[model samples]
Target: MMEFKRKALAIAVMVATSTLTACGGSSSSSDPDPVTPENKAPTAVTLTANTVEENAMGVEVGTLAATDADSGDTHTFTTDNASFVIDGTTLSLAADASFDFEKMASVDVDVTVTDNGGLSHTETLTINVTDLLDYYDFVSEFDAEKSSVSYSGQTARHALIAELKNYIGNGGLQSDVDNGELSSKEEIVAKLNSFYDRDENAWDGFAVTFTDAKQKFFSEISSYKSLKDKVAGNDASGQHALWNGESNEAGQYTGENIAFTGWSTWDDAPAHVPADGVIPQKTPHGLVQQFFSQIADNAMENPGGKRYIHGAEQIEANEIPVFVNYDGTDLNQLIQKFLLMAVTYSQATDDYLDENKGLATDNTGRDKGEKDYTKLEHQFDEGFGYFGAARNYLDYSDNEIAGKVKTEEDGRADWNGKHDTDGDGEIDLFSEFNFGASVNAAKRDRGSEVQTDFTKEAMDAFLAGRKLINDAAGTELTTEQMAELLEYRDAAVLTWEKAIAATVVHYINDLRGDLDKLKAGADDYSFTDLAKHFSEMKGFALGLQFNPYSKITDEQFVEINTLFKDAPVTELSEIDEYQSDLVKARDILQAALEFDADNVENW
Candidate 1:
């Protein structure tokens, strides 16, 4: 029986073994079937929105993060906006991306994080751009009231022209000219003074008499009393005004009204209206009539044309003929001369005297006594008017007036270089009329307080000098204070004269360069081209004659004129003949002006 059981168990065991062997044989030598795990989607990512200032560089908005329950899952990041860039799980503004608060205040970006398994989560990011000017502290320090003074000179100019017109229309000028009693500008001017002194009656053709016009003009000149009062208290109006004043000394108020002194002192005076015993190409009477006629005609022709030349294309001859100084000085040159004198000379000179003499200490003794407007203060404000800048000249962000402060080369209201659009080395009359103002502004701006900004240095210097006078208005200045003030004035004068000298040097170099180009076989030569250069040279030479306080002597003036004669040198080969003469003239000017070549180049 045991033998039979053993045999059965063995048979069972054999059967079990045979079953295992058969299963193993079916699977061969391979491992058991692997269990299949369920796939899980990645968790949605939550990214924080970021805020950055405008013009922020390389700022990271946020890092994209995600969780995947399934192992070995990889993730990628992206953004919908081109300005946003994605790398791995991180997101940031693109390298070259920039923002302008003026243009766009903020930007919103949508970001996405995608897992290797194709699951994605998106979040919107917000970027806020802030204005740079808003945080700037200097904006508040800028004096807008002081800046508004820049237009006062223009007002004075218009008033002077009106006065001249009034004098002419009253028939004083006509009667004098027709009777040959006013054979020269000096005689005409003297006769006009008699009319002013007598309060001449208006003729049948006139709207106003000379006395009425003088009153109106003086009113305009006195309108700056408010600005002047802000700095000091000494009446600078009446005869002491830059256009009407007469004094044996530069800054002294003689209380004598030298009628139309501004017109008589102008460099173009002899040309526009001949002085005593001299002949004029165009009489002041004729010029004034022509000026008014042209203006009336232009208004009828191009009714919408701008009154001033702002760019190259706007420099048409008859449109704004007063903006140029060539072919001898025009009415505009007369106006500019007055404006410049008001700023750099009249006001500047008076301020120096006030500092040295303490004229404002006893305002009761001066003309228009015990007034709120001091001579020093009025002079300073008068300067602003002639500068032709807006009240916010320092606010470069102010698009309306910022151009006034910008450099000529950068194309900001630069009527000077703009008229030279052809690169022919010669500038139009527009440039000639506008060049001195621009050059003066540049010289004045180099001393601005703003490090990164262009401001009027000359204007600032004037303001500073005025402030010194104003501070000492009620008090007598000590000898030390006087010396200090005089020193300041002297420094300013040096800078101004240097600036003018530098401009002369630049004109010389331009002429020299053009000649060099001609000698080098440039093909752009023509009779007109040579004439244009000669004209420019002559125009600049004429300017040298009017250097502030006559720094350019008679000999220097004669030498310059002789060197740059108006001869019709149409031949290109003949340009070289003038080279040595030009160099000699240049060297003479440099020596006379004490201009260092390196320093002049900087100007």
Candidate 2:
């Protein structure tokens, strides 16, 4: 039994050891599989709002970022607003985004971030738009002034002639000469001070020369009347009647009786007298006054006569509507026209080209001393004065007239102000008139160096010509120098012509654009407001005629005249006819100036 028990115990131990070993080996295989966590949505980071200027370029609004709990997840970004764009979790304003402060101050954008697991988070981004800085308020007022200004009949040159006639008759010059007390020219000049009740300083603003031209005119007229008196022999009234053609006999007789019946009649008057009769010497001022007086007389006779005076309306046969101030204080259209005409036609064409060409080359007989300028040089200088160009106009690099403002002292805001803008020494008339056109053209063509070169060349030529005149004082020009002067003159003329043509083209385009806007109903403008635009357009068109180098033919002028004949136009379509004519005129002017009018359309 003991032997058997031992044997069984041993066997039991062996069995127990084997079972324990089996359980340990099975533990490795029986363990459950390891558990994994599920995937989660990304956490989107909060973005701050931003501010940007209007028309800003390449502005970065914010970066859109997201984090995924899942491993190896890629991120992407996008915006709902077309104004914004996104690339790989980065957000930015679009390159060509239009942000107008006037229209809208700010814009909101929705930016979304998404992970590769299909989870997206969207956040609102507010972008504040700021305004651009404005330096000057020039364009608005300039356009307003252009529309507001009024143009009327002859009130400048005609007023001047009428005042002269009235002064000669009412101011006692006629009485003094007819009584023979003021027989000599010197005596008549001495008497003029008493008539005005002031010194020669009072006449400084008058365009006409008081001392020389006035005295010479009176002297010639006095001498002619004396000759007529001698021929009539106490029947002098009949002789006056004959000279005046019996129509103007009813008016009071004075030195103002002279009229431009005919140049031949006045020249042939010595033949009417005996062999011992005195011959009258002709003076330019006298002839000009007589011609003007004839126009005044014709205006008196027919009332609505074709013989209209340049700058005044005919109140009567011998009367014109006069103004209080004659020295450019009256900013009427007639006055402006007269001033332009004085520079371009009277001084430049008549005096400089015709009457004083002799003095241009006469070195031996040059007028020197205190009165240093030659007749031709003075005439040219006078034209420049009328244009209001500074003596050293070339010193200015640009054409912007500084110090311009709305002031009563500036003569009714005719052209901003008569103040000395551009830092020149003196306040001149018409300084910014047509000169602004040239300056604006230069600015507009700044991108084209070749176009700017022409404007610069023009300015240089004008400066050189003015310098020639200024230097020619107390001396005469040599043949070479004279030729150079002429060349400079021609260059100035051509350049200014081109500048004006460019200005006209620019204005035409502007008008067309404005008309298009009106047609499209982009601007809410009334008919009255629309008329102002037409008026401004007509005003610019009228300026074309004032070009010193006029490219418009008579036929073209007639066609252009039809545009303004119906003033204060109400309809947008009303300008269509005018626009067609203007385009034609612009083409002609461009062709004359050798300018390429590309893509110029009526609309």
Best by lDDT: 1
Q: At residue 325, what lDDT does model 1 achieve?
A: 23
- Looking at candidate 2, the ten consecutive residues that score lowest on lDDT are 147-156
Segments of candidate 2 deviating more than 4 angstroms: 1-346, 353-369, 397-399, 402-450, 453-455, 468-479, 522-549, 563-569, 572-575, 598-603
User: What Cα-based lDDT does every candidate model obtain?
Assistant: 0.44, 0.42
In candidate 1, which residue ranges exceed 4 Å CA deviation? Answer: 1-155, 158-371, 383-457, 514-558, 565-574, 592-603
Clashes of each: 12, 6
Provide the TM-score for each candidate, comma-separated.
Answer: 0.41, 0.38
> Against the hidden true structure, what lDDT does model 1 obtain?
0.44
Candidate 2 backbone clash number: 6
